[model samples]
Target chain A: MKKLINSADTILEESLDGFAAAHADILLLGAERKFVRRRTLKPGKVALISGGGSGHEPLHAGFVGLGMLDAACPGQVFTSPTPDQMIEAAEAVDTGAGVLFIVKNYEGDVMNFTMAAEMAGREVASVVTNDDVAVEKSTYTTGRRGVAGTLIVEKMVGAAAETGLPLAALTALGEEVNRRTRSMGVALLPCTVPAAGRPNFALADNEMEMGVGIHGEPGRRRVPLASADAIAAELLDAILKDLAPGKGSEVLLLVNGFGATPLIELYLMVNAAKRILDSAGVAVVRFLTGSYVTSLDMAGVSITVSVLDSKSTKLWDAPVQTAALRWGV
Target chain B: MKKLINSADTILEESLDGFAAAHADILLLGAERKFVRRRTLKPGKVALISGGGSGHEPLHAGFVGLGMLDAACPGQVFTSPTPDQMIEAAEAVDTGAGVLFIVKNYEGDVMNFTMAAEMAGREVASVVTNDDVAVEKSTYTTGRRGVAGTLIVEKMVGAAAETGLPLAALTALGEEVNRRTRSMGVALLPCTVPAAGRPNFALADNEMEMGVGIHGEPGRRRVPLASADAIAAELLDAILKDLAPGKGSEVLLLVNGFGATPLIELYLMVNAAKRILDSAGVAVVRFLTGSYVTSLDMAGVSITVSVLDSKSTKLWDAPVQTAALRWGV
Candidate 1:
C-alpha cells in the first residue's frame, strides 16, 4: 500500500497537529498525545466527552463544538482510547455542571470510558450506544456493538448539554436516542490500513461480508459479492427486519456510506430501502444520506433507522450548533 | 463487481429518505429530490452551503451543523451535484442574510455551484476553496484545487456566520482562511464506487498516485509509491516549499486520512510534519488528526496547514457550536 508518512510512530501526533492547526477555533491539546478537546470550557454546562479508535473521522473530535461533545480522546488506528487519555479529557472539559461520557458499545471502548468516568473526581454521567441492529444484540461478548448510532446519541445528548440540561437528562436522552435507533452494516471488500500496509481481511475478488464492524472485524456472514441492488436489499432487509417498523411508523432513515461506498450506491440503496419500507407501510419522515461514522475505507454500507416519536423527534428538531453538525428549524 | 440496487435513478430519493429518517432534527424538503437544508435558519447569517460528489462523506452533509455550513447538497456518487440541486440548496438555505456558496474548486463542482448561485433569486456570496498544495497554484485555472482545506474554511467561516458576521466579513474570513492554508495528497490504490464496484484506477502490486483527489481524480503527479516517511517528506516538502511559512510563523496542521489510511499511519506522518516545521521554526499551535474529508475507500492521505496570525488563532479559540465542530473555552 502506498502511504505518506515519515514513520509509522509519528502519524497520529502529526495528524493531530495538522487537524488542530486547521481548526484553532477548536483546541487540540495533545497533553496525553491522543486527547482533543474544545479550547473553551463551559463554566456550568455539563461537559460531554466521547472517544474511541481513531479511524472514524468527524466522529468524536469532529463533533467537539457547541451542542455536542466537549472533548474527545482518540486511540490508535483501530484501538480504543486508553483510560488515562479519557481521564484527562474528562478533567479538561469538565465544569461545575459535571460531565457525560458517550461511548460506543465496543468492549474496549466501554471499559476505557467506564474507567475514565470512575477515575474522574467530578460528577459524571454516561450512556452506551448499542444500537447496531446487525448484532445479535445479546450474543456479543460486549452486548450489542455500537455502530453508527453513536452519531445520533452524540448529537441529541450534546444538544442537551449545550442547553444546560443536567448530566442526568443528557444521559437519559442518550439512552432514549439509542432506544429509537438501530443499524446494520455489510462490507464488499476489506480495507487496508496504511500502517499495516495490507488488507485487514482477504476476500476473493467476488466476495462480500455482512454485519461487518468498523474495525474490519470478521462479519457474521460472508458470501459472493453481489450486484448493487442485491447488496442494498441484503442490508435493508437486515436493518428493517431488525427494526420491524410497523405500518405508517415514522422512521428517520440513514443510508450510511461505509468508508468506501460511493454516494451513488448509497442513493441507490436508499431507493431500495424506500421501496422496502413503502411496501412495509413505513414512512420515512427524516433522512441523513451521507457518512456520519465510517470504517476506514471498507467498501460497504449500513442502514440505520430511528423509529421516531414526539419527544425524540422534537429533540431531533431542537436547535443545535457544532463544527460538523447543525440544525434548528 | 457486486452491489445492491434496483436502479440508479431512484437511489438519491431513497437515500434522502433514509438520511431524513436518521436526522429528523434537520428538516428535509425538495421535490426534485436533489437538495436538503438545516431545519433552523438564521436570517441574514450568510447561509453557508456546499456540495459536490457523494463519496466524500460528511463533506457537505456532516458539515450542516452550526459552526460550519448551514446546508449541504449531495450529488451522485463521484459525480457533481446537479446544478438544480445546488440552486434548490441555495433557495432552501438562504436567509435574508444572503448565502455563501463554498465550492471545492473542482471543475464540475465550481461550475455547478456557481451557476446555481447566479441562478438563484437572492444575491449570494460564493467562495472557492483551492488549497491543495500538490495542485500547483495557477492562473491557468483558478489556483490549487480545494481538498480538505475546504473543511477548514467551512468550520472557520461557519463560526464567523454564527457570530452573525456580515456577508462581506464572512467572505473575507473565508478568503483569509483559504489564503493561509495549503494541502497535498497521495493514494496507494484507486477506490471503487459501489455503483461501479471495482477499482477506479489500476495499480500493480507496488504503485501509487502522489496527489489524487477525493473522487480518484488523477493527481498532479504519479510516482512509484514510496515509504510512509519518504512519501510524507515528499508531500510535505511540496507543501512547505510551496506555502513557504516564514520564520516565526505559526500553523494549524491537519494530517487527513483519505478513505483507507488508518490513524497509526497518520501519526507517523504527523511526526514528519512536525520535524519539517520544527526545523523551519514554524510554531504548531493546534492540530487535528483523522479522516475529515475522505475519498471512497482510497488508500491515501492528505496534509493541510493554515498559517495563522493572532486574530485567526483567537477565532480558533472562540466559543462556537455546530454539529461536527465545536469549542467554548
Candidate 2:
C-alpha cells in the first residue's frame, strides 16, 4: 500500500487537533472530532446537525456555519459516527427550537443516524435523503439510495431551518427536496481505500462502472469506457428521464465531480449537459458546477437536478456560511 | 483509459448544465461556464476573480461568493482557461471596484491568468501565490510555486477585501499568510486526465511518490509504499522539518487526502499526525481533515501546517462560504 501519512493509528486525533487549530473560529470537540460553531445557539433558532464518514471532503464538516448546518460530527473514514456520538452532537447543539439531522441514504449512515435520532427523540428531527436514481427498487437495499442528494437536502432544509421553520416544516422541506431531486453517477476507476492501501475493486483500464455509489460500491451496470460527451449523454439522459424538467418548470443543476475528476472535465461535462438539456427544452435557471460532495478518489462524476419553485429557489439563494456547499444571493 | 464518462468532447458543457440545474439559485453563464453568486454584487465592492484548470474541483469556481472570490473561470481539465473566458468573467462580475486576480503557482495557470489580468488592465489587481516548499528555488521555474497556499491567501485577503481593505493591505496580508504556511504532499498513483483517459504516470503498487504537487507532476522523491503510519511520518516529518510547527507556536494542521483515500484511513492518519504534533508540543489550535483539494484519484495524502497568530487566528475564524471550504465565527 502506498500512502503519504505519518501513522494511520494516530491520524484521526492528530488531524482533529490541527483542524481545531486551523479553525479557531469554531469550538473543537476532540472527543467527537467535531467542529461546532462558536456561538452555541441563536435564541428561537433551530440547530442543524449533519455527519458522515471523514473521507468525503467538506461534506459534513464543511457545511457547518451560519445559514447552513450548525454542527457537523466526523466519524472514522467511510465509517459512520457511532450512535452515541450523534446523540451527543444533538444534545450539544440543540436549542429550544429543535435540531434537524440531514443524513445521506447509506445503510450504515441511515442506521446510525436513525438510532441517534431515536436517542435524540424530541430534541431533533432527522431526514434521510434517498435521491440517487442510480439504484432502482431492490429487495435487499432501500430504493434509490442517496448519493449527492445529501447536498440538496442539506441546502434546502438548512435554509428552511435558518428561516425559523419548525421541526415539522424543516422535515417536510427536506423530504420535498429529496422527492423532487434525483442524482446518478459513474466511476472510471475504483478508488483505493487508504487503510487497506488497495483498490476497492479492480476495473480494467477501459471499463467504467455506471451508477456507482459513493463507498466504492459497484454500480448497477458496468460497461466499456466511452468519451466525455457520451458519458454526459448517458448521465443526462438518466437524470432527465428520471426528473424530466419541462417547460415552465425551473431546474437547479448540480454537476459534481467525484474525487480525481478535474474541473476542466467537469466544466466540459457541464457544457455537454447543457446541450442535452437545451435540446430537451429543459428550463435551467441556476447552475452549480464543481465537486460539492465526493467519494474518495474515484474518477467519476454525478449530476443532480432539483425541480425548483420560487420558495426553494429563494432558500437556495440565501447566504450560507459553512465549511462546504456555500453560496447565496 | 478508464473513465465513467461516455464521451470526451462534451464533458465540461454537460457538467455545467447539470450543475446549473441543480443549483438554480446560483446564476451561471451557460455559454461561458462561469460561476457567479446568485446575488448581485453590492455596490462599491471590488470583484475578486480567480480561476485555473478544471481538475481542481472547487478551487477557482467553487470559491465564488461572499467573503471569497467574486467569480471563478473554469478551464479545461488540467489546462488553463482561455484569456477571453476570464475577461468575460471579470467584466460580468466587476462592480466598479476593480477585480483582484488570485493565481496559483502552476506555470499554465500563472501564464493564462496573467494574460487575462493584463487584458483586464487597471480594472483588476492581481496577486500570485508562490508558496509551495517542495519545489525549491531554481531558474527552471518559479521557486517553490503555490500549492494549497493559494487557498489561505484567498481566504485571508478575500476577507480583508470584503471588509474594504485597501488593495495594498490585501496584498500584504496575502503575502504574510503565504509566508506562514507550508505544504508537502505525495501521490500514490497517477491520475488519468479526461482528455487523456489513462494514467498520466505509472506507480508500482508498492511505491509512493513524495513531494508531489496537485497536478500529476514529478515528485521530489519516489520511494517504496509504506504503511499509512510511516507515510504520515515521512510527510509530516518533511513538512514539519520545513515548517517546524514548534512546541509553543499555534499551528493549524491539515490532513488532506489525495483522491481515493477513505476517511477511516484519513482518521487513522490524522490521529498519527496529532501524536507527532503533540510530541512536539505545538499549541495546536485548528485542524482540517478531508479531501479539500485533490489530485485525480491519487492515493496519497498531504500534511499542511500554518503557524498561526491572533490576527490570522481571528480571520481564519471568520466565516467563509464556498463549496469546498467554509468556516467563520
How accurate locally, in lDDT, is each candidate? 0.73, 0.70
Best by lDDT: 1
DockQ for every prediction shown: 0.29, 0.32
lDDT of 2 at B163: 77
Residue range A136-228, candidate 1, lDDT tens digits: 543333667888888888877776676778878888888888887888888877776657878888888778778888777766778886666
- Give a tens-digit lDDT track for model 2, residues A57-144: 6577656766778777777767787888777777777777888888877677788888878777757677888877777653224666
**For residues B222-269, could you state the per-residue lDDT of candidate 2 as single tens digits?**
888776667667777777778766568888777776655644446556
Docking class of 1: acceptable
TM-score of 2: 0.77
Q: Interface Cα RMSD for candidate 2?
A: 5.0
Candidate number of the best TM-score: 2
Give candidate 2 misplaced runs (Cα > 4 Å). A1-39, A42-128, A137-140, A192-198, A244-246, A288-293, A327-329, B4-54, B61-128, B137-142, B158-177, B193-197, B227-233, B236-247, B250-297, B307-329
